[model samples]
Target chain A: NAGVTQTPKFRILKIGQSMTLQCAQDMNHNYMYWYRQDPGMGLKLIYYSVGAGITDKGEVPNGYNVSRSTTEDFPLRLELAAPSQTSVYFCASSGPGSNQPQHFGDGTRLSIL
Target chain B: TQLLEQSPQFLSIQEGENLTVYCNSSSVFSSLQWYRQEPGEGPVLLVTVVTGGEVKKLKRLTFQFGDARKDSSLHITAAQPGDTGLYLCAGGPGYSTLTFGKGTMLLVSP
Candidate 1:
């Protein structure tokens, strides 16, 4: 049902370059999140938005930016891509209910050289 | 830092065998969720155990939550080839963030 969709399944970037990771959901959920997973590590939150026009930094928000302009779209931006930023990025969305399950996107695999 | 520790970072077994993966933490959670992720795919929710000491079964898979809500386990009976994937457990302590485990990489041979 197009629960959560992320763009650019794979990407290679040069150091200091900037790019945006796009995420969209059709579930009409009010909560959206961005997370990154490193090799052999658990996912770390990058940013999150409770509703449109409201966003907050997460555990690992360094070198990342996010915007929630609409209920369905939340994009994560990397201002200066670094080698440490190379990882798999996931987008998730949930409803208003407490502890509701999050629907995850296919994830974006990005590498910086 | 709230962390979930998963036991035996990796596992390999043959079809028709049974295995169990564990997830443990020192903090009490309001609920826990299990997800299975295949190569190059996002994780799909397997089950959610909310109450302490709760157990649920889905086909060959069984999920159990600890009495203290600080631990959980996944048991697969008569495993099949399709069970090969990464299993992750996430704890939601009624917070906005969902903390996840390192994950168990299980390989079920045919």
Candidate 2:
């Protein structure tokens, strides 16, 4: 059914480089989010968008930026990637609101050296 | 701050055994969700518990929401190899976004 799809399943970047992690959902969900999961740690929300043209910052949004120009896509941009940013990034989507469960993408494992 | 914490970070048991996983929080949430993630894949929804004192059951899996809505628990009866995975709990923040717990990895061997 092509739930949530993320591109570039794995990547290696040099310190200070920049890249964008792509996320797209066809479920017509109203909420989309970007999160990072480090080893032994839970997922941390980086950014989220409620709908097209609306976005907000989450717990760890310092080095990341997100844009929701379309209802089906939300991409997280990492500016000046650092070694500390090495982690697996996940994208998720949820329906109408408060009580819905989220569906996640497989993830993108990024390693910055 | 991270809002959720899960106990028993890792668990290994024989098939047909029983196990319980916990998720606790200091903040109140309108809803709580459980997700199971296998290696190399994203977390998949297992259940959603809303309202204090709410309990839901799916086959051998039983989920309970704390009476105060600040904690939850998952109990699997007679666990099987298919139940092995990383179990995560997520709470809906204010209106959107979810705060996830550090997950419990369970290994149910045959």
Which of the numbered candidates is closest to the native, going by highest DockQ?
2
Give TM per candidate: 0.97, 0.96
Badly placed stretches (over 4 Å) of model 2 are none
lDDT of 2 by residue, A1-113 (tens): 99999988999999999999999999999899899999889898888889999999988899999999999999999999999999999999988674788999999999999
Docking class of 1: medium
**lDDT tens digits, residues B37-58, model 1?**
9999888899989999999999
How many clashes in each candidate?
A: 0, 0
Tens-digit lDDT string for candidate 2 (B5-48): 99889999999999999999998888899999999999999999
All models: lDDT? 0.92, 0.92
Cα-based lDDT at residue B72, candidate 1: 97
DockQ of model 1 vs. true complex = 0.61
* Residues forming the 10-long window of minimal summed lDDT in candidate 1 chain B: B91-100
Query: DockQ values for all predictions?
Result: 0.61, 0.73
Q: Which candidate number would show the highest TM-score if scored against the true structure?
A: 1
lDDT string, candidate 1, A1-113, tens digits: 67899999999999999999999999999999998998789788899999999999988998999999999999999998899999999999987533688899999999999
